[model samples]
Target: MGVSDTNYQIVYRGHHLEYFHPGGWVFFQRPKEAGGGFWLGRTYDFVFMIELPRPVSLREGILYLQQLKYESAS
Candidate 1:
């Protein structure tokens, strides 16, 4: 899990959905073994009650969170 002034991020080392940030956004990140990558849109018409993913690794998840902040800032 990660927290910053702009947003919060949680990385699941395992496969399971146990948390979410209401009114926020949800994204899916494919594992590296399965072509790992992720892209998050700037805005959404609706809120996502669940944000879950089985990232390739914890590093990938941290990278995703970093991008999340950068992308959303723009």
Candidate 2:
């Protein structure tokens, strides 16, 4: 297994879900495929959390996360 995954238990990978930070942040590792993301397949650059300024509904929060992921990747 990868070093970053040594002590980490990943529930999913493809959907930008990897590990969780203590501060309620989730990380999504960029894939090694072409045009992956900001991390560009580098395991270390896999920070995928964005803190929203205001409180949002659970559905909105998920949308924000997805937006952040795409923004960061582009």
Candidate 3:
């Protein structure tokens, strides 16, 4: 499958988060000091982050993964 330039926005805690145009299998990297680490107290440190290709639903994510697999097989 080809890539899609779909985007999604998320708002939380009075903050607006924006993500750039994305395709399948999006990932967000959070800082270790900001709670993305393996520590216990800072578990909720990832306050703001966004993923690409925006999963409209669980089924959509599944389909996207399947498409990725198909593309890799080719």
Candidate 4:
């Protein structure tokens, strides 16, 4: 199933934490934090689901998201 088959929502604004679900999987981006401008949250859902090995950086998260799409393609 290509990523197109997988239901999801995407957020890019750097505002307060936002929540949105476009399909079976929920997606969210953690708001920026007070820790020296680094986002204390995430660009992808990590709080309520997706047991990540460790918190991923913005770039890493984006890359992983891309991979998710490709994987589904295969």
Candidate 5:
């Protein structure tokens, strides 16, 4: 699937975290200080959801969410 740049930009970023809300889905990433690296994940209902591999960086999370946005469109 092809994703438009304007459509998938992250909606928010702060405190070492990033957020993207594309349609009903909510995607976010946060640092895992204890174990190191970061946590990247997404949800539709905000309760049940999916996660990218752990031990990732904040940049990786953003890309993952962007990809999710594109894939979800399909």
Candidate 6:
């Protein structure tokens, strides 16, 4: 499956969030909203989680991860 079709597991506040596809080669802010935290990860078998001043949207995070997968695949 392509990066766009990959599924992700997102946990927020001890709750499970829906899986979303992060685009390729994109930067994603973290936490969900503003003033939460930031996270970074590769589509491969590794993910780097970071804390941000604000919670970013899930779309961005997912897209960024997908990009990583694409890059590694290349």
TM-score of each: 0.34, 0.34, 0.30, 0.43, 0.40, 0.40
Off by over 4 Å in 2: 1-50
Alpha-carbon local distance difference test for all models: 0.45, 0.40, 0.34, 0.44, 0.46, 0.45
Where does candidate 3 clash, by residue pair? none
Residue 2, model 5: Cα distance from true site in angstroms? 27
Model 2, 2-58: lDDT tens digits are 226333222223654444444343323334564332221112343433444343444
In lDDT terms, how accurate is model 6?
0.45
Residue-level error in angstroms, candidate 5, position 46: 11
Query: What is the C-alpha lDDT profile of model 6 across 1-74, one tens digit per residue?
Result: 12343444544543433343443122233344556543443232234334333345666666666676699999
lDDT (10s digit) by residue, model 3, range 7-59: 22222223323443333133233344554311111012343233233323434
For residues 1-74, write the lDDT of model 4, one tens digit per residue: 11245344434345433454422332334445622212222233344455355545555655666787799999
Model 2 earns a TM-score of: 0.34
> Distance from true position, residue 72, model 3, in Å?
0.3
Better of 2 and 3 by TM-score: 2
Better of 2 and 6 by lDDT: 6
Over 8-41, each residue of candidate 5 has an lDDT whose tens digit, in order, gives 3322234422443534333333334455554444
User: Model 5: how far is 34 from its true place, Å?
Assistant: 4.1
- Model 5, residue 49: distance off in Å is 6.2
